[model samples]
Target: MTQYLAKYFALHRKLVLPGIGFFNTSTQPAQLEFVEKTLHAPVHTINFWQDENVADNNFISFLIKETGLNHYETINKFSQFITGLKEKLQSGVALKIPGLGILTNNENGYSFNPENLQQYFPGITAERVIRQNAQHSVRVGEDEKTSVEMHEMLNKEVVKDRWWIGAIVLAVVGVAAILYYYLSR
Candidate 1:
């Protein structure tokens, strides 16, 4: 029965046990670590809440379909399983839901400790590669521009700032020419 619940939770990413609460699975997308130069794998996390008021219609329907049992039988079987879980929790035994995590009844409420399944997923080395002259799309405000175009625009601004250097060189050349001509004469 625990296996069925775990299988259903794995397939649907959600489960709502009528008398207990709800379980939900959320995924964090793979991320690139700039400092480590590695691409981390995506992570799937399960969360549980001990709200007795939550509905379990979808879970009941899924169980009915998977177990080949009628609605009443399915509900009965599921309730029996939940009753066992509740009894264990009430007796101070932590319930370990396979493939999910451990659940314990704390002073406040039910506390869930999710299993660390990261050992099954591995990350790969992914170094950042940026080509200097490579043309790529870049978003600048509301407009899209290419890398090469932006590079040229930036260089033009730099050239404008250094315009005085060219003027100073021409002035020095003119002064040398004038001195040479007067000395020759």
Candidate 2:
């Protein structure tokens, strides 16, 4: 499987790993020249993007063909398998698919650990534009401020409880000492 994937990528410069994602290689145009005296060709660079649809389709087809099952049954089985694998990966476990690559979570997001050299993959490089979740930068309003203030008030109660606990301990020790003196007499 790994050899097949390696070769597929080597030939097509891209391979969509089932249940994982697509590995692509592409080239980028070189930096622009402000004033050119002579006519020269621009340089190009390679890049890659993971195709979720392709991966999902490949996974479904594999289940149907390999198990010789109907579409519904194969889909259910494949869905469960994919869900389990996704859960494992989301829970910080790396799924190493032979010849394909390793799927692991980083601090920022999920990343692929390709077995072959990155150059072989071609246009797989850092993205120029960084996309982020819309919910990540939610605006805090008056209600949110009130909630934060309420939490702060609860924190004060926690400190008050600690003080009361210390006072209770001292009172108990004093009573115990007085009882010990009377009993010893």
Candidate 3:
């Protein structure tokens, strides 16, 4: 169930729980830091909002069609799940959705502290940064500057071509699994 929810969040970008809240994805843009000498990768975070009174629309039909589950049963399952989640939040317990962050209620409403994946890009792993900013300003010929540029470009390619983010990815997945198991129980 949690797996499907994660997948749906990834694919659809928005998921509404019948009486709990809806989850959507927001983008953090890539940035280049000249002073820091680093290029930050863009990433996505889950944004959750509570709206208990909203009507079921195309999402319901989409879920039923996609999962091949009975419409009423699907609704009931989601309803029960949302009810339990609400009860937990009302009880002052934080709910953690895998790949997402902790969901808790406050005086205003529910808030989600999204897990940061800022270091990793989709399908690209963050690699060990090997370049150090030059300590002193030095005059360089056009050919030398071009060579440096090519070296930086090649380094970026190497980082993108490798699958080195496996450990971080697994750790996140593991944490999500633990949270899911703990919550589902």
* lDDT scores in order: 0.86, 0.58, 0.73
lDDT string for model 2 (12-60, tens) is: 6665644546676654443434354232233222233544566546545
- lDDT leader: 1
Which one wins by lDDT: 1 or 3? 1
Clashing pairs in 1: none
Stretches of candidate 1 exceeding 4 Å from the true structure: 127-185
How are the candidates ranked when ordered by TM-score, highest leading?
A: 1, 3, 2
Give the per-residue lDDT digits (tens) of candidate 1, residues 115-181: 8767678888886677767788999999999988888887784434788889999999999999999
- Provide the clashing-pair count of each candidate structure: 0, 11, 0
Report residue 111 deviation for candidate 3 (angstroms). Answer: 2.2
Q: Please state the error at residue 11 of candidate 1 in Å.
A: 1.7
| Model 2 misplaced regions, further than 4 Å | 1-20, 24-59, 117-185
lDDT of 3: 0.73
Q: How close is candidate 2 to the true structure, as a TM-score?
A: 0.38
lDDT per residue as tens, model 3, 1-185: 66666667777888776767787888878776666656667767777788887655666676687778998987887678778888999999998887667889899988888877664553333456555654333346543345456556568844355465888899999999999999999
Who is ahead in lDDT, 1 or 2?
Answer: 1
> Candidate 2: minimum summed lDDT over ten consecutive residues — where?
37-46
